[model samples]
Target: MFKKILIANRGEIACRVAATARRMAIQTVAVYSDADTHANHVRACDEAIHLGGSAPKDSYLRWEKILEAAKATGAQAIHPGYGFLSENEEFARACADAGLVFIGPPPSAIQAMGLKAESKQLMEKAGVPLVPGYHGSEQGPQLLQREADRIGYPVLIKASAGGGGKGMRAVDKAEDFAAALASCQREAINSFGDDAVLIEKYVQRPRHIEIQVFGDTHGNYVYLFERDCSVQRRHQKVLEEAPAPGMSETMRQQMGEAAVAAARAVKYVGAGTVEFIVEQREGGDMNFFFMEMNTRLQVEHPVTEAITGLDLVEWQLRVAAGEPLPAKQSELQIHGHAIEARICAENPDNGFLPATGTLAVYRKPLAHTSFQRSHLRIDDGVREGGQISPFYDSMIAKLIVHGATRAEALARLDAALAQMHIVGMATNVQFLRGVLRTESFSQAKLDTALIERERAVLFNQEPLGLPLAVAAAVAHTVLQEAEGAGRDPFDRRDGWRALGAAVRPFAFDFHGETHAAQLRYLHDGALYLQVGEVAGPLVIGRLPDGETEVEFNGRRHTLRVDELGGTAYIFGTQGATRITAIDRLAHAGDTQAEGGRLTAPMPGKVVSFAVKAGDKVSRGQALAVMEAMKMEHTIAAPADGTVEELLYVPGDQVAEGAELLRLAA
Candidate 1:
């Protein structure tokens, strides 16, 4: 094995690679941008080097800088962890030219699979089953529209150089094909710098299943079973599992053989994944078509590791060192069922838009830290006070669980999500739990549209009831009194009513609605609350671990309350809610702008303006596109009106809620 290696990436994947390298007694070097100077990955390695700016093009994507850092640190090889330069064929070749080993597939393999248009041709020539579509080299808009019409309506416009659901759009009719193609091509150019695209027939009831394949310099190969990545949102996998539900031995073997053949055709080396779009049919028949091959380690590789009992990164290191395949196809075996949920800092209720902020309070489930339970694991590269900046991916961590059966794994995953607590920003933890508890998921009836199919229950947001709201106010007051009293019990004057019952009024805002309540402190150490025609006496007790227990209407409930920046965040079994204290006496006028203004939802750079000033638009029409957190968000018109002003141009970075345009009423 190489003595020292450089990890040319950031975030959790970089930390993950460092863990494995350290176990192999190999020193690791980490490269970071200005945004990630104090990042977790930098702390995981023995040495670190500074890259450039926070944007990927200025830092992680700078292959020359990465090579310089590697050479300066005396690293013999470089591991491109998943994103950024992982699939850049030119970067791989540059590493080779610098006399440093690239711990991934050969540059030839990356080049062959990097472009979907050409890869489809290669797969077809290799006898791999392919979907019916247009994979030709013609890049004309008219030619692409003609092909889309030929493939019938509901065709998919996909960027030839896209992954992670970027630069792809589904058109349902001929009239929408032109706009969809333009948007797809624009995103393609912005993301991959390639405007070429391919049109394919959209498969109904499609299930995404990919086979993990590995190869060595000695020309040996093996398939590490498969992962079912069918549960997706916006064409990106949210939850993944190994040993796909209802998979038969015969189908597994056939898919495995096909995957190996595709890899051998390119003379693949190191780790790669062969993705397939499997179409479910009546009876038990399924037909799978080759989608694309990822020429590096995958984000969902942990699920593969849990089932196969192999460290894929370690395998990458060994193979890059010219070692033979660790095990033959017949020697590998699937152990137990495993599932992984990608925990992202995103708001599921608001179209899953990525969120950026400082993590005032971050805590993972305690179950993941028990060494006795080897089945539960968490892979993260963030700390409690880290910031989720807009310059990188929004994925905060991945929670993986294993069990003897799929049912057990599902149960464990749900429990773990419930135990997680994150403050200062929204996350998808509750959304993930809702998916795990869905009837379709429990029965393993999964597909790419599962989330959309279960949208009603998945997006349901229950109101923060009066009970919880009252509990939050009381908890806040109790904690404040305790802190002010210091260590002396005599100084604790909570509920003291020597001058008769005292009434304290509290104002709070929850979910855009303001509420007020009055708390009466009785001389007998009791409290009573009255709010909007509801009057009740409540009992509050503090637990040893700082949790609050509230008794109301003869029922007792325990909740965790975190007060930060004058906002009391209460977390219960139902979910979490933020209650900000309002000062009614010193209140100011509302700062919200009128509804006719179109504002940026988050901090991002303007990618394009579909409509300019004086252009008439209808409600729900796309007005502009903003790119943030590596994803594009479309800003639409609120009402049918003429655009009066365009405030910002393309490539201008704007803050959240910055007015981008105004529509004439």
Candidate 2:
């Protein structure tokens, strides 16, 4: 095993690698950008080195700087933790040239699998099952459109050199093909510096299952089963699990063989994943076609680890140090089911827009990062007060759960997500809980389009139920009384007391709507609250689990309090939201823009314009494309309008909500 290794990445993955390296008695070095100088990964490593500026280009993506830091720290090997330079073939070759081992697939394998087009070609040559599409070298729009036509409508336009959902678009009709292709190509050029794209047949009801394959320098290889990554949004995975739901033993063996074939075709070394898109037909054929192969450890690798009882990072180190495969494929066994949900700092209600803020309070459930037998697990890198910056991926943590069966695992996932307490930034926790409660998902009927197809019912931001309003009122009363009762006689209690008059009604906003609530402090052991005709007094009970329980009418609700910038947030049966003590200056002015004109949603470079100064566009029509967080977002017209101004051109880097185009209603 290597004595010291450099983790050429940051954030949770870096920390994850460092933990495994430490367990194996290998010292770890961490590289960080200026923005991540105080990052969790840097604090976890044995040694740390500053890369460069805050932007990824200046730091994480600078291969030379990373190499220099690795050498200076005396790290014998470099582990590219999933992103940035993980799949960069040149960087892998550079590490090899510098006499440092790269704890990943060989540079030749990365080169062959890096480009989607070439990988597809290689898979086809190796007789691996491939989807019906065109991976040809043609770049002309007309030619690509012809290939799409040949493949069929509902074709996928994907960047040949793309990952993380960047430079990918699904066109359901021929008319929309041209615009989608142009937008995709522009994003491809900007993100990957390659405008090359390919056409693929879009599989309806597709389940994304990828096989985890490991290879050693002695040409021995074994597959670690597969992970079902069907739960996705905007072509990005939100949840994943090992031993795919509804998977048969026969299907698992077949996929294992096919994945091994694809890996062997490239003479793959170290860890890699062979992704396949399995189509669910009426007969349950389990026919899977090869997607591209990821030439590094996956973000969802923990699920595999939970099921297999193997440390993939330790294996990476041993293999890079000229060891053979740790165990034969036959010896490996799937102990139980494991599921992982990505907790991202994004607003699921607002089209899943990414949000950023200092984590005033961040607390994971008291579950272990790895479970024995069946339990909940969490893998994360952020802590209390960590900043969820916009310069990197919005993912804050990966919550994993294991159980004896799929049903149990799903239930644990729901519980863990509900137990998650995060403040200072919006999250998709409720959205994930909704997914778990979904009838189709609960029944193991999932597909790539599950999130998009069920988005409406799954993402409810309304505060409609009367019970929730009453609970909020009671919780509010408890907090108010807690603030008042604990003080001495000199403290003023009449913010709304008004010297023994009618109770003053106050409004509190939760889940985007205001609730009218009345509060009265009682001399009893509880605080009294009234909402319309409903009345209740909630008792605050301390729980053994370190979380407070709010009780009312023989029912108990767990509450987690988080304070951010003087604002108090209460999470529990009231769902999750900011709970201020009914602000004194409550009649705040509207934050909506004066003219109701549409603007950019985030800081990104404009890549496409569908309208000019005078073109008429309808509501929800694609008006422009903005690329941010390595993904493209199509900003649409808010309402039917005539374009009055073109505020930006292609390649203009604009701030969030900066005017991209003015549309006159």
Candidate 3:
């Protein structure tokens, strides 16, 4: 191994790479932008370097700055962890020119698979299965429309240069093809600096399964099975798992072989993933088509690690050091089923809009070392009190669980998600939990459109459990007393109120609703309370584990509490939130009808505005589009009404909750 290596990335993946490097006794250097000066990856490294501004262009994407940092730190190699400069062929070549080893695939391999248009041609040349579409060099709109028509309706217009759902559009009809092409190209140019796009046949009920491939300079190669990445939103994967559910041995072998062939065609080196779009066939075997090859370590690599006993990062180091493949194809085996649920700071009920805030309460379940016993593995970059800035990806953590089978893995994932406590930001945790329990997912009947199809049922936030409410009531009372009295008033003899006939009435707010609770001291460190319309008294006790136990009307209820910065979190079936008890009269002006108006969900530059004042529009009509965190969101009319005002224009930067437009009801 080298004396020192630079991690050309940030967040969890950088920390993940450093961990394996540490075990290998290899010194690691971390590079950070202004936004991540105190990031977790920086703390994990043996040495760290600042890379200037917070914006990606000013730092992470600047090849010269990263190269200079690597040279200055005396790093002999660079590990591009999946994004930013990971798949940039020019960057890989620049590292080679700088006499530093690139810890991923060779520059040639990256060049071969970097562009979608070129990769499809290479796959077709290599005899790999491909979907029928246009990968031509023509850029004219009429020519592209012709190709889309030839490919059939529901074609996917995807940018040839980037991933992560940017510059990707799915057109369902010929009439929408022109506008979709323009939008895709515009996003493509802005995101990847490449307007070139490719048209592909959109597979109905598509299942994204990718094979993990490892290669060495000695021409030796092997496969680490496959991961099912069908759970997605906006064409980006939200959850992934190894040993794809309902996968047969024959199909696995075939896909694995094709993936290896695609890699070998480019003389690939190091770790890469060959993603295939599998179409479920009725009464027959599924037809798998080559999508593209990711020329670096994947974001969902932990799932692959969970099923196999090998450390992918360690293997990357070994291979980059000119070692042969660790194991042959026949020697590798899948031990158990593993599933990874990406816990992003997004609101599933609100069109999955990304949210950023301080992590007031972040707690992960216990993680296990091996796959032999069913266990949970949490890979995260942020801790409690950390901030999720608007400058980077909204993903906070990834919760992975392993079990003997897919069913067991799903069950563990569901349980782990239920136990997770996160506040001070909107999260898709509850949404993920609902997805795990959905009948379709439970049955392994997954598809790319599952989220869009079952969103209504999955995101329904109706109050379902009474125990949760009781627990919230109890926590609210305890926190209020703690704040007012400067300590737990139910501490010693002072807690006893036997000499008086007085009770304390406290008000609490949660989920836009209010409740009243009256508390009085009881023996044995218990507090008695009555909340809302409940007829009987409630007893609240704190357990040794710091969990709050509630007994309402003789019925015992258990709940987990996470307190941070005066925000109390009561975790149960009612879901998670930052709960604060306040006097209704004091903060009466805080409420607003912001969600009812067409506003920018996040701070971003307005890309386009389609409607003006007095424009009659129906619900869900696109009124404007805003780009934030590198993702474009179409702001639409909430209800059928006339546009009363247009408050924004193209090229305007608006803050979250800033009204961009208004519709008269």
Candidate 4:
């Protein structure tokens, strides 16, 4: 076994690798950028080295800098945990030439499978099942359009070198092909530095299932199992599970064998995943087509670990050290069902737009050890004061749970999700809880359109849970004040005064609406409370666990309450409700819309403005493009207007809601 290694990534994956390396008694080195100077990953390893700027291009993507960091730290091997240089062929070759072991597949395998266009060609000859599409080298727009038409409408244009759901577009008709292709190519070049693409038939009802395949230097290969990654938004996975719910034993063997064959075709070594697009038919049958192969560890590998009770990262180190496979194909067996939810820092209510800010209130549930097969596990490297910038992926953490059955797994997942508390920025925790409760997901009728099909229930904005939260907040404040108060009248917070009865007013904002509550302290030591139209004699107390218990007219309610800064979080069986305490002394201003101003939706760099000043454009016309979090967002004209001014040119970073352009009616 190697004595030391360098992790060439950051965030959750970096910390994850360090954990395994520590367990194996291997010293680990971490590299960080300017933005992540105090990041958790930097503190995770045994030692650290500084990279360049915060941007990926200046830091993580700079292979030479990473190599030098490894050399300086005296790392024997380089573990490219997931993204960045994980699948870079040139980097792997460079590591080998520099006398450092690359803890992944050989450079030849990465080069062969790195590009989807060429990989499909390799798969076709290797007898792997492929979908009907175009993977040729022709770069002409007309040629690609003709190929799309040939493959029929509703085709997918994917980046030849793309992963993690970037640089992909779906065109339903020929008229939309050109614009979609251009957008896809731009994202491809930005994300993968390759403008080449491939066209394939987009399955209407598709479920993304990928097999976890591992190979060693001794020509030994095995497939651990499959994970269903169907629940998605914008072609990115939100939820993934191991031992696919409806997978038959026969199909499981077939897919596993096929995946192993693909690995063998590449003379593969180390950990890799072969993803397939499974078409769910009207009856019950399924047909899977080859999608692409990820040449590194997958983001959702925890679920596989939970089911198989295997350490994938440890396997990678052993394989790179020229060790044989740990277990044979027959020894590998699925133990139980596992589910993993990717918790991201984004607003599901706003088209899942990535949100960036300090993690003012970050919380997680109880975590089990890496080898602890069942229960809860949280993989993350973020802290309460950490900043989530637009320089990388928007994922905050991953919550994984295992159980004897899928129902139990789902129950545990939902409960664990409720335990997570996030503030200072928008997150999808509530959205993920809502998704778990949807009929399609609850009943296991999952598809890529599950979120869209159940939007009505998933996006329910009814403020029914606000009352408990309000009561909890009031109860907590009263309890805390009562503890520190003596006989002093001014220190008493029970609306006390020299008068007969004193009234205390409290206000909080929830979901853009402000609600007020009044508490009256009577001379008889009883309290009267009223929130909106609901009024009653209230009795409240604090539980030993710091939870608040409140009663209104003999109806008792217990809730978990936590306050950070001025934000109060209440978590109950109905999910979490965050309310901001309103400061009455602050100045109140008139709320009005700023018309004819085009603003950036989130913090990002301006890619380009399609229209300049004095140019007339129609409503919903593309006005500007903003790149953030490794994806490009198009800013469109709100109405028919003439462009008046451009606030920032291409490559200028803009804050969220910054005015990008001025439009005149």
Better of 1 and 3 by lDDT: 1
After TM-score superposition, the amount by which residue 375's alpha carbon in candidate 3 deviates from its true location, in angstroms, is 2.5
lDDT of 2 by residue, 497-581 (tens): 4344334466665555566777565433335566666667656655565455666654666766555554556677435655544
Tell me the number of clashing residue pairs for each predicted model. 0, 0, 0, 0
As for model 4, its CA RMSD to the true structure in angstroms is 1.9
Off by over 4 Å in 1: 367-373, 486-495, 531-535, 588-595
Candidate 4, residue 614: Cα displacement in angstroms equals 2.3
* Superposed Cα deviation of residue 123, candidate 2 (Å): 1.5
Among these predicted structures, which one has the highest lDDT? 4
Which is the winner by lDDT between candidate 3 and candidate 4?
Answer: 4
Which digits, one per residue and each the tens of the lDDT, describe model 1 over residues 1-665?
A: 89999999999999999999988899999999999999999999999999999999999999999999999999999999998999999999999999999999999999999999999999998888999999999889999999999999789899999999999998999999988898898899999999899999999999999999999999999999999999998788899999899999999998998999999999999999999999999996899999999999999988899888788898999999999988999999998899999999898999998889999889777644221225888989999999999899999999999898999999888888877889978899888988987888989998898999999888946535765766666766776686688676668757665678888888887777888888888877678877777777877878898788877655677778888876887777766666788877667676666677888888889998998789999989999999998788999887899999999999999998899999997
Which scores greater on TM-score, model 1 or model 2? 1
Lowest-sum lDDT 10-residue window in model 1: 365-374
User: Sorted on lDDT, highest at the top, how do the candidates line up?
Assistant: 4, 1, 3, 2
User: Which pairs of residues collide in model 4?
Assistant: none
- Model 4 poorest 10 in a row by lDDT: 460-469
Candidate lDDT (C-alpha), each:
0.89, 0.82, 0.83, 0.90
> How many pairs in model 2 have backbone atoms within 3 A of each other, for residues 3 or more apart or on separate chains, i.e. clashes?
0
